[model samples]
Target chain A: MIVQTALLIGLVLFSVLAILLRDLLKSAISLAAASLFLGIIFFRMNAPYAGVFEISVVAGLITVLFILTIALTKAGDEVRESRVVNWVFPLFFIAFIIIDALVMKGLLRKIPALASGAETGTFGDVLWKGRTFDLVGQIAVILAGVFAVLALFRKGDKHD
Target chain B: MIILFVALPLVVAGILPLVGKVSRRVVPDLLANAALLFLLVYAAITGRHLIAGGPVLQQLSWFGEPVAIRLALDGFSLLMLLAIALVGLAACLFSIDYMEHYGAKANYYALFLVMIAGMNGLVLATDLFNVYLFMEVAAVASYALVAFGLGRDELEAAFKYLLLSVVATAFILISVAVIFGMTGSLDFAAVAKALQELNAGAAVGVASAFFLMGFGLKAALIPFHAWLPDAHPSAPAPISAVLSGLLIKVSGVYAMTRIFLNVFGLTPALSTVLMSLGALSMVVAAFLALGQKDMKRMLAYSSISQVGYVVLGIGIGTPLGIAGGLFHLFNHALAKGLLFLTSGSVQQATGTRDLDEMGGLAKRMPITAATNLVGALSIAGVPPLNGFWSKLIIIIALVQSGHPVFAVIAVLTSVLTLWYYLLMQRKAFFGKLNEKWAAVKEAPFWMTAATVFLALLCVGIGILFSSTVTTWIQPAADVLADGVHAVIGSWGF
Candidate 1:
């Protein structure tokens, strides 16, 4: 329980720091850190698959993308300070969360219970049976990416 | 099978690069044209079947349980597919010669086919998750197509489109996640049933708002129209035609109307909101279009304006209104596609896209001039053109529905459309010869052929408006007019 609480607090702290950081590169790193903490929290809650995706995709791949963009653009630190969080807003947010949690607890009692094994499905079955068209969509997206990169990096007359 | 509508293009897209390398001209062009022709013929047969009151559902299953992906053949999806196939065919024809200037014809055709597959999937999808996924597919292809030239302007426009589209997708995914959390299902029928049981509280309201905003961005409605003027004009002409003529309708207007009318029965509040958005896009984009010096940019803005008429018509929630909106959808596709192709021809010959630099091109490029005149008159709502009947229907529907103020605004916007199009004509094709383009020949035969085909459609559909409406549009509108419960019943889920 104590470790779970620490992970939760780390998630909140890194998320805020990510937004508050002036340098975009540092902000990206902070965001990755927050994603890592969230992944730990998910694993603690028995969702290993979700945790794995969060760590690999959000924390790993996305951080590399952000770093590449920063390097290519040669961007400097943002001049303006972030005003995303303030004292009154946090207090109101905390109060709203409390009320929402209580209301959700009441609502949960009214919902039907899950059937046996209803919450689980094999990955292949879930993707093939549940999202056939999405697979087609993913194929299109990957092909588009391939062609887009080819078009962008083609060797030819540099005429604009 | 409905799957063939999506699969044919994809399979061809997968094989195009290999074939293009061998014979860039013959192999790729023939295969692309053949694929599109097959899809068009298939769409026609299925649309006729649906029009004659045929079967509405086509299910594909794997092992034991039925798959979540369902493809529906309703009147509405049939009409949309027909529009997509027709526009895609015309654009493909135009691109045969137009894409030669930019090498790698194979890559271009490959991406184009993928985009068509994505749109076809989007229209036929029966689940919310598939809708979002197909929307992403279409969006991704379009971003690349917009930047295909790799020029400075093209890259900038593509990046802007990409950033905004990502934001829109995020919003849509959030809404989808919320609905899935509440309902434990992704299929449209299942979600509707669950929401019905749950009494559809604040969560549904929030999701609906997100849907409107997200789809609104894709539609390039007034508030989220920043990327269109840049991106549409920056892409090659055929891509511009496809993007303005078909993509927005499939990914934005069609998705929004289907979800609102079929999934979450339309309330007065949602109807009013839709109408207001339509009105705002109509007036604002018209004014913005009026001052544009670039030819394609003006047409892009005009698309947002025409889409307004459609949204306004559907928002009225009457049968006449919905039919009028749908009719406008078909007519606008032909007229706008024709105009963009004509602009491409002029640009190809004159080496410029600025309207200010063009003059009296009729003497040099008669085919382009004549076809462009037809397209311009059609879009400007001349009495003999298709745009006239659709606008008249929408305006009359507005008046009949007791929204006289919107009717007046619609009329004023029509006049504004006419004024700008006439200005474009006078500047580009009617005045004294520019002398620089005196030796410019008419666009190549295929380009002229494509433009002329769509031009004839603009006039033909106008003259045959009644038959066209009865045969094509009314059945689609009937699907929307039936409301949510009837739609769910018809799905037989």
Candidate 2:
């Protein structure tokens, strides 16, 4: 449990750095890594299916898409816009408020209660018996996604 | 039979390109329209009931436990299906000639049909995950359609749309994951049942925020509307018609309404959030639209504004409000579809989408001019048109619910809606014929036919609204009014 908390803290720190990083590619990779760590935490919490899906879908597929978009757009050189100091004060103020709320909300206490006696069947049991329609819907979404990407990337058509 | 509403479209959409490959030019157009017509007929016959004693459980067993992939049709789904089918048939018919300018007729039809299939699947989906999948299907096709022109602007707009949409999907997926974590169920009925068992708090608040942002983006509400003005106008005219007429409503607004109302139960805070967002989009988009010179761009903004009305009405969470909202949805689809198609016709004849570039086009394209006028007046809430009735109902409901301020805002926005629409009319259609467009003829027979059909339907529905309400609008409203409890009760889970 100590190690898990440490890993989560590390992930949160890395994710903040990632968002502020100079290199887009490095940011993407760092974000993916953070997602991986978060997935691991989910697994430690006994949500193996969600953990796996998180690593595979969010970290793997979406990260690849982001990279492809970055590559396609030729955005290698980072645009370092000057930051507004005024913005930072409010941003940190909001962040502190959120942090305070998080600590006071008893969320940590609730997590263990949720973890106890949670369903432990394979991903199929929850997906089919509990949420089968979502799977079918996801398939439909993937089909649309694939087609849209194909249309954008289609070659040798110069009718514009 | 319920499944066929989705399956028939999927099968036909898949086979359409191949069929087009074999047939003569006219056959593909006829077949596509005929297919939608058949689906429309099928839905009408099936009416509002769930397919009784049908295969309620079809477990593929591939993913592990026998997960039943279910599709159920109810009044709300049926109404939306009918709307998609009706408008889709008209768009397909109009495209027969409009698409002649573009060379890839087969591919265009294929994408169009696939989008229809996705929308059908979305409306009929009883499960939350299925909603995501179907939403993607529609979203992806829309992205491709937006970029179909392959112009620099088209590519730019499509990319922006794709980026924002991906973010929205990610938000929705995360919410779905959280909901599954909370309830251990993905089916809408099952999720609602489980949610009732759990206490509402921060976790649910987080989930609701995810849904709000995700679906809000899809619906193009105020803060999330940056992509819409570009994306909607960038598409080819038929595709624009579809985007404005149906896409945003189905994937964005409809899905949000279904999930929030039927699945998660609309709490006071959420309803307030929806209403405020709706009001913001309505006022802001209308004001922004009033300053635009591009005719289609202005209309695109107007679409966002009108959608605000629908959302606001639904957000009120009264039976009358929901009914009014759904009624407005139907009317907006017709009016907006007609307007977009007519704009396409105008663009084709004049070779520009700029309102400033057009003058006195009414003389040359009389059919388009008349229909565009009808659409404009209808949208602007002129008396006896469909828009006025729906807007009136919404205002009445608002006043009845003791929200006089919102009712006043709704009224004021109707005038604002008129201001931009009239500005659009004066600049594009009402002035003297431009010398450069002296040779411009009316849009071809089919496009004119489609525009006229929708225009007439707009009037017909307005005049015969009482019967239409009794038959269609009331049932759909009842579904939403029944709320989360009725939905779970219906399943007998």
Candidate 3:
């Protein structure tokens, strides 16, 4: 329990750091650290498939992509953020944490356990047979993302 | 097949980019428009027969074994499907001409079709997780479409929209997670059954709250509506039409009501909350719309306000009220869709969205002005238009339900709606000719045709409302009026 709590704390800390850090490289690294912590939590919670995806896809592949993109682009003119956001985000964050801490424990106690057993079958079985509709949706989303990239990147495209 | 509703557009979308290489303009245009026309025919004509007996449940079988892609179409989903196809085809037709100068027409059509597929999938989905997945599908496509112009305002608006939308989805996901934990099911019928057996009010309330915030943001309900006025106006005009006319209704209102009325079963408390939110959104957004100078921005706020009317009518939780809400939804989809398309025409001709910039456009573009007036009056709830009947039904339902104050509010907002719409009409089209717009021509054939299509439907539905309501709205309202029985009894997987 202590180890799990520490890991959860690490996840939140790194996530907050990812948002707060000014340096793009540091922010990317912080996000990676957060994802790693989350992946560990998922594994500890018996969701190894989710853990693997979180670590490999998000913590590894996405981090690399972010670093590569950041490396390729020169920093543009410094953009100043609003003063309101600096304080407001943290304020909301703290308030949410407080509310979660107060409400979640009692709420968790009240929630009756699921009437059914845990998800069964292999990952492929679940993917192919249990949730085939998701695959269609995923395909459409990927198609959307690809088309978006193509449309947005098309050159010399100015206001009509 | 019901699956075709999702698969057809997605299949076409997948081919469009490749097809762009061969013939960017003509082929993509024809293919995309053809796909939408097929959908319209399938929904408006074929859908009725399929659902006449009862809900059509589909489970695709590969070879001999059935896979778990469960989709269902009932009266309510059929109504939504019909609305999506109609507005989707109109927007696609409008895009034929309007997207000419924007370039990369194939890519544009591809995204548009994908968005339509997403919406259709959402309505047809039998499970909760699938609903979330499909909503995201539509959302990602819209973010790109909103920023398709690649201008500073477009990019900025898209970014803000993306941020808020992410927040909305987070709340929704959290609610889904909580519900899953308690019920161990994501299918609508199973969840409804589980929730009824459990009777865990506090947890259910939490889930419902998260859902309300999520969908309210999607619907652009007041207080959660900061992103819409920016995002709607920033997109290209046809996109604006779809965004205002269809996306919010589909993703926001439709999703919310389906979950609330069918899956969760609307309690009096939930009903009260919904009505309060509806009243708030309708009243506040109407007032906000009254002050806008940008033509599309005004329309965007009006979308929010009208959506409020939809929620209010549905919130009454009666057959007549649900019918009123749904009828308003369909009418607003047509009228608002028409208004936005005409706004696009005006923008294209004049190169501005500022209503105060010019006058006397009626002389130059008579059809556009006429269509624009039709849209404005319909939305403003003027007589002999579809909007009038729907609003009246809602008001009457409200009074019968002992919510006279809300009824009064709805009436006053209608007047406010008329006031601003007239202000827009007078400022842009009525007065002395704006010398700068003298050379502007009527919109190209396709654009004019699209506007006319929706405009005529508004008038036709108005005149033939009883028949239209009997054929379309009654079935849908009956299903919703059935409450939990609509799902638990028939939607078993």
Candidate 4:
């Protein structure tokens, strides 16, 4: 529990750092760290499938993509100060605090218990049998990701 | 198996890249077309059985016990599958010629096939989480397809689409998570049954709001519609056709309707909210389309307006209303897809999408001109066209449901739709031939063939309107009207 709390704090700090960092590369790295923390939390919560996906896809693949995008564009060293964000952050922070408090106090109690179905199945059984279509969808999405990358980076088209 | 509807294209999409590496460009094209054709043929063969079979529920199992990955097919999902297969086939055929210049033909076909797979999964998904996942699959593929051209405008539009879509997906995830937390299962039937017993009005209400925001953004309804105009017009024309014609209806309107009507019983308040959004999108988008100079952009705005008519029909929540909505759904797929493809041909032939830059190409590109005219007049609600019947039904439904003002607005919007489409026709096709495009010939044979096929469907469905409603459309409406419990009972889950 202590480790989970520490991981949660690390997630928040890394996320804030990702947003506030001016250097694009550092921001990308911070975002990856945040993803890593999130994956750990998912694992702690007993959702290994979600945690593995979060680590592999978001922390590993997406972070690599972000770093590559930054490097390919030679944008990592460029940093610009944003007066607008400084002005906006406090208001957002306050709003978030208020919503969090309302949820913790009044709104949280309304949540109902989980609805267990009539049948129970193993995790693999649930995924393969109950959610087969989603697996197909995920494969399509991965293929789309590959094609999108190829389309963006491939050369020799006159339309370019 | 019921899973074949989603699995077939997916399996084909997975192999397309490897096949492309070995063969010429046409290989991917032929293979993708074959896959879509197979699905279309399969749908045609089995559609009757599904509708007659009452509800086809196939559960994946382990240890001889039913498992969570279940697929449910009723009349509604069958109609949607048929629509996806048909429109996807037309888009693929059109892309064969149109995508020749885009380069990376194999990659484009891969993305396109993936999109078809996603839509098929989305429509057939029996669980809330699967719907969300399939929606993302379709959404991500479409985002990449939007940016496929890699032009300045395409990238900008894609970035905007991605950002807004992420927001929408975040909302959808929150709602799904909230529901799962409240009702231990993500299965649609289980949640619906559990929700019925729980005194969770406030929670359901908030989730409904999130769903409306999410799906409304997907559908490009009036208030949440900032991204669609730019995104739709910026993609390759076939992608634009698929986006406007099928994606929004399936992911946005269809998913939203299923959730609101079936999972959450459609209360009067929800009905009012949906009807209001529909009316707003219908009238507002038509007015916006009037002043657009770009041909595809104008058609994009018109899609939003036409979608309003569908939403209005569905929001009325009457049998006639849903029937009208479903009819309009299929009609829009045929007609609007035809219009986008025609615009693409015009753009391909003349090298411009600006209506003002295009004039009197009728002589040079007779097939395109004729097909464009068919699409325009059909969309304008001309008598004996499918659009006319659907719009009339929706308006009549509004009146019968005692919302005379909305009915009046519906009639006015139909006229408004006609005014702009006629404006588009006059400016682009009916004028004296632009000397610049005098040398432009009809689009390549395949493009013309695809457009003509959709055009024929527009005309044929209109002519055979009653038969279509009875066989294809009405059963879908009956499924919606029967509510969640009846559907669940039919599945015997």
Model 2 misplacement above 4 A:
A5-39, A47-112, A115-120, A123-135, A154-160, B20-27, B48-67
Inter-residue clash pairs, candidate 2: A128-B67, A134-B129, A134-B130, A137-B130, A137-B133, B360-B431
Sort every candidate by TM-score, greatest first.
3, 4, 1, 2
iRMSD (Å) of candidate 1?
4.0
Name the lDDT value of residue A123 in candidate 2.
72
State the lDDT of candidate 4 residue by residue for B1-493, as single tens digits. Answer: 8778877787787788788778747799899999999999888787677658687788776688765667888888888888898888988999999998888887888888888888888888888988998998888889989998889999999999999888888888999988988888777888888888899998898899999999999999989999999999999999999999999999899999889888888889999999999999999999999999999999999999999989999999999998999889989988999999999999999888999998888888888989998899888899898888988888888889999999999899889889999888888888799889878988998899999999999889889999989989998899888777655566556
Per-residue C-alpha lDDT of model 1 across residues B100-136, encoded as one tens digit per residue: 8887777788889889999999888888898998898
* Local accuracy of candidate 2 as per-residue lDDT tens digits, B40-127: 8877666644433321333345448544656666667777888898788778889988887665566677678778888988887777
Ranking by lDDT: 3, 4, 1, 2
lDDT of 3 at B48: 96
Predicted structure with the largest DockQ when compared to the true one: 3
lDDT of 3 by residue, B1-493 (tens): 8999999999999999999999978999999999999999999999999999999999899998999999999999999999999999999999999999999999999999999999999999999999999999999999999999999999999999999999999999999998998998999999999999997999999999999999999999988999999999999999999999999999999999999999899999999998999999999999999999999999999999999999999999999999999999999999999999999999999999999996889999999999999999999999899999999999999999999999999999999999999999999899999899889999999999999999999999999999999999999999999998999999997
Error of 3 at B64 (Å): 1.5
**Candidate number achieving the greatest lDDT relative to the actual structure:** 3
- Relative to the real complex, the DockQ score for model 2 comes to 0.31
DockQ metric, candidate 4: 0.55
Docking class of 2: acceptable
TM-score computed on alpha carbons, candidate 2: 0.87
> How close is every model to the real structure, measured as TM-score?
0.90, 0.87, 0.97, 0.93
In angstroms, give how far residue B150 of model 4 lies from its true place: 1.3
Native contacts recovered by model 3? 0.81
Pairs that collide, model 1: none
